[model samples]
Target: MRVLVTEPLSEAGLALLRRDFQVDVREDLTDPEALAAAIGPYDALIVRSQTRVTARVLEAGERLKVVARAGIGLDNVDVEAATRRGILVVNAPQSNIVSAAEHTIALLLAQARNIPQAHAALRAGRWERARYQGVELAGKTLGIVGLGRVGAMVAQRALAFGMRVIAHDPYVPRERAREMGVDLMPSLEALLVQSDFVSLHLPRTPQTEGLIGAHELSLMKEGARLVNTARGGIVDEEALAKAIADGHLGGAALDVFAQEPPGDSPLFHLENVVVTPHLGAATAEAQDKAGTQIAEMVRLALAGEFVPYAVNLSAGAEVPEVVRPFLGLAERLGALCTGLADGALRSIECAFLGRIAEADTRVLTLAVLKGALSPIVHEPVSFVNAPIIAAERGIAVSEVRSTVSRDYVNLVALRAETEDGEVEVAGTLVGRRERLTQVLGFELEMAPARYMVFLTYEDRPGVIGRVGTILGEHGINIATMEVAREAAGGLALMGLTVDSPVPPDVLEEVRGAVRASAIRSIVLPA
Candidate 1:
């Protein structure tokens, strides 16, 4: 395999790839056109934040099978375009958790002890010791948002500092927070009112953008400090700047900005503001770990071995010796149920049966919840806080375990009930492959490929013909089609696995033509 290394990664990471592949290193392909041309002949591409993997780059690499990011975020890559082309997207989400958590603590301590300010004063020959008064972290309340891997690590460190830690992640359970020595606040407003310092650790999404704005800042106590190491837009920069300038906020330390290499902003001129160029994952250890980890994943994928970190695909319960693929199967089933359920989900029922039920299967349950709920909620979730997340959303979830064998070796069934109706999706592990076996009792088996279209209508003699005619007219060829109905003229479900995705407008047209009761087209990980 020929692998292209587009940026500087650790030698430790590059060593793994060099062992089995022909490696090409190009540390100066800053020009998009040059990068595009060079990438055409490679089987894999490795990059850091500087390089952009656009659609043109993917198109150039007709032989490309894997694109690995040596960091947590994939904002630099065109994931949608890569998925459309059936290319695997992999990232190391946990590689930098410790580094980022320690950095957040370092920034908090710097703010409290006035380390940077004091160093500047002493260098400038000003002996103003009284003006450089410092405060202790002991007993101060630290509020954390997004209690994910990084957030939990930060909470642990803050507790070691003798500080009282409180958090407001909508997805973390009360029991989990209690175990971590954090008092879970009901809302962000409650956390702001009680905390001496607030730290942000959320993703940049439509709901989280400008999460800490003027209204939220106004709710905070005067002289309270703010720290953001997550994503830039999570906090409203202008509002934060105003709060600091008006003396309502004591100080703010930001490691990320809404804009990379942020242009002149209101926060730039404030003396109390501390900024870093998005250095959350800047440590040597983190970079090496991320690079090596992603390199191994790419190697496994190219060799047809099961990759544990694949964000878009799963190999089911039976695969190269690991903690069973049942966990991944559960997650995919959760995502499927969440997609089909209507209205807001009020409850979830997860039942584990056969061999999977007899083992310690907490991870499987967590995987299912994370896959199912991540799309609808506004917080970062993991196996540790799945149940807590459900509780916070006012959704009750129940788990039933049984050892009786069923049709498959391991089966995970997820049922969600809402105002619209109840939808149940189930999946099973068959040998080395993971197959989705059932959807609301509409029995069918699919490979869970990246692109799928499901339609339910009255079973008629010409139904399949009409559907095929419309897709052919739109130039969308059917790769595989599965249809199941109880009886003639009865309710039927058709699952169409397509070679390429059906455009939104084309799907709408199909829905109109069939006069269908429900039509859902989505791209799952293949």
Candidate 2:
């Protein structure tokens, strides 16, 4: 196997890759056409932020099994195009968290003290101490927008500075925030209103792009500063400049911009604004970590093993024979549980029971996460980034192994705890075919399908018939149906797999006709 390195990588990483595979370092392939020409002979390609792995380049690499990024962001790589070509994409997400957190703190202090301005003045042989007067961080409230790994670290550092930390992350549990010695606010507006300084640590997703705009900045406390070290395009640069210029905000600091190498922005002209050329992960230690971590990931991908940092691969490169049959079942169960769940999802637990528990079930857990998050999140969820996406949304995920199974030889159970209540869905393989075994503690046998409907209602003689009638009237055919009840005249659960999606109005009509307490129409991936 041969691996190609397009950009500068740590010598440690190059040595590691050279151990098993022939390695080639070509730092001059910065042009897309040049990369495409040189990529044909390589089995794996590794790069940093400077290289753009375009679709054309991926198309030219016929032997390419994987594309590895030494850093966290996949902005430079065409991930969707690679996935379509059955190429694995991997990245080192944990390589730069500490570096980024420290950089955020450095920028925060610089902005608060007007360090850059004062230093420039002193270098120019002038002294203006009063003009550079700055505010102290002690006794101030710091609002964190996204309380993921980097945000959590920033909170700890801020706490040591004697600053009160408040955060707004709907996906994070209040208990978790309390343990971090931080207060979890009910909403973003609430945090913004009380915080003396606001910091952003969110990913650049469709939901988060331009997250902090004019109105959001306007809501901040007067003279409150803003810090962004997470990603470019997350904060509205123009709005931030106006906020500082209008004197509504004391100052702002940014390590990233909407466009890299941003030539001239309105924010650059403002004396109160501090900017860096995206140096959040520029430390030597961070580069080494990123390079070494990505090398290991690429090696695993080449050896047909499970890679924890894979970005596009659906499942592990290798799977135990015994546990292989349940991979799809676990994902379907995850999607089912998520679909049936009500209110906000707080936590998800995956339990591997009986014989399957004996095998390495980490890939199966990743399958569940991918299934649970794919329907809701804006970006595509893969076996690798599922857990990260869950954490970002404050959704807790856990897994357990149990050798004991009540009935089936192997069972995969997915339970989702929502704000309203908990919903559990369990599945098993029946002679190589996936089947739904239990839902919400009600056990019934039914084959999983692309479109399904579940209903909870009072156990009555005609309730099931009423549901069937409504679906049939709408030209929806039921492929399979199962009903489970506690006892006579008790609460009952009915599940059905249909030939096509049941429209919402039709579901509503069925709900009313059957007088069902709850109903969910789920459309799972084929």
Candidate 3:
């Protein structure tokens, strides 16, 4: 295998790649046409932020199995295009967390003390002592916009400076915030109003673009400074400039702009404003970690092994040992829920119970999403694009975890809300085998197979026999079956796996014979 490094990478990473694969370092391949011409021979391509892995480039690299980014973001890479071509896109997301957090603190301190202005004034041979006097960080309230890895680290460091730390992140649980010694604000507006200084540590998504606009900036405490090291366009640059110019905000420090190499802007002339050329992940240690981490990920991808940092894999990667056994169960349950759904899907909720909930169940959740989408969509659905597809279809997805299990030692459940009603399916791993434990509140144990059928009818005798008779008449073989009831003759559910898919007409006949309230024939992936 051969790997191409388009940008500068750490020598350590290059050496590691050279151990198993032939490596080529071409720092001059900055142009897209040049990269496309040189990419055909390599099996893997690695780059930093400078290289743009366009669709044309991916098309030219017929042998490329993976595209690796040494940095935290994939903004320069055409991920969707690569995914379509079956090329794995991997990134070192965690390699720059500490560096970014430290940079945020540096910016916070710089803005608070007007460090850059003071240094510039002193260098210009001006004695400006009282003119450059700044406020102390002690006793100030620091508000974090997103309580993610970097935000949490920033909170820890700010606390060390004797600053009261609070945060606003809907995705973060309240207990998690409390454990971090930070107060969780009810809303962004509330956090902005009370915070003496606000720091942004959020990803740049559609919803987050211009998140802190003029109105949000106006809500902040008078004279409160702002610092952004997360992503560009998250904070409205024009709004920030106006806020600072009108003396509403004391100062602002920006490490990233909406556009790299941003041309002249009004914020450039502000006295208290400090800007850097996107140096949040510029530390030598960060670069080395990014290179080494991405190299290992690429190596794993090349070897067809599990890669924890792969952003586009549907399975193997990111699944913990305990959660690995439940991936199939989760996906099967997802397919079952969708199969049982009566109307258009509106939302999906994945609940993890028992010991499995203690692990990082993201991969399992992704499996569920992939399963839910694969059956209905015209295009292919993988773990990498399931979330995106769900969002595009306006389907809300959520995950809930609990360490306590009511019956099984571990359970993965999927509840999908549709326009008509909701359908729920739950499953668990039983000694390396998958078993369906619950379906729409009906509790029964049955192994899931490639072909399965579920039916709801009156708890009457011979209902199961009649269904079996119909299946037998249609030449459908029942592999396993289970019947659960709410009461003696009130309502009951029959679930069974078949050796072959039950014909649609045969399923209808069975439903009519048993007078089933609901019937669904589901076909799961092998």
323, model 1: CA deviation in Å? 17
Mind giving the per-residue lDDT tens digits that candidate 3 earns over 1-526? 9999998898888888999999999999978999999999999999988888999999999999999999877778887688778788888766777898999999999988889999999999998989888999999999998776678889999999999999986544465678789998889999999999999987675457788999999999899999999888989999999999999999999998898878998899999998999899898998899889878988998998877666556433435678767766787788787778876577899999999889999888888887776665422355555786566455789999999999989888888888677788888888998888889998888888988898999898788788888899888899989989999989998889899877778888988888999898888855
Clashes of each: 1, 3, 0
Q: Write the per-residue lDDT of candidate 2 for residues 1-526, one digit (tens) a residue.
A: 9999999899889989989999999999967899999999899999988899999999999999999998888879997688778788988877888999999999999999999999999999999999999999999999998887789899999999999999987656677788899999989899999999999988785557888999999999999999999888988888889999999999999999898878899999999999999999899999999889988999999988877777655534677788767867877888787788875578999999999899999888988887787665433455767888687667888999999999999999888898788988898998999988899999998999989999999998888778878889899999989999999899999999999888779999998888899999997755
Residue 133, model 2: lDDT of 97
Ranking by lDDT: 2, 3, 1
Candidates 1 and 3: which is better by TM-score? Answer: 1
- Over 4 Å off, model 3: 315-412, 415-526
TM-score of 1: 0.69
Considering summed lDDT, which 10 consecutive residues are worst modelled in model 2?
374-383
**TM-score per candidate:** 0.69, 0.76, 0.66
Model 1 error, position 457 (Å): 24
State the C-alpha lDDT per candidate: 0.80, 0.87, 0.84
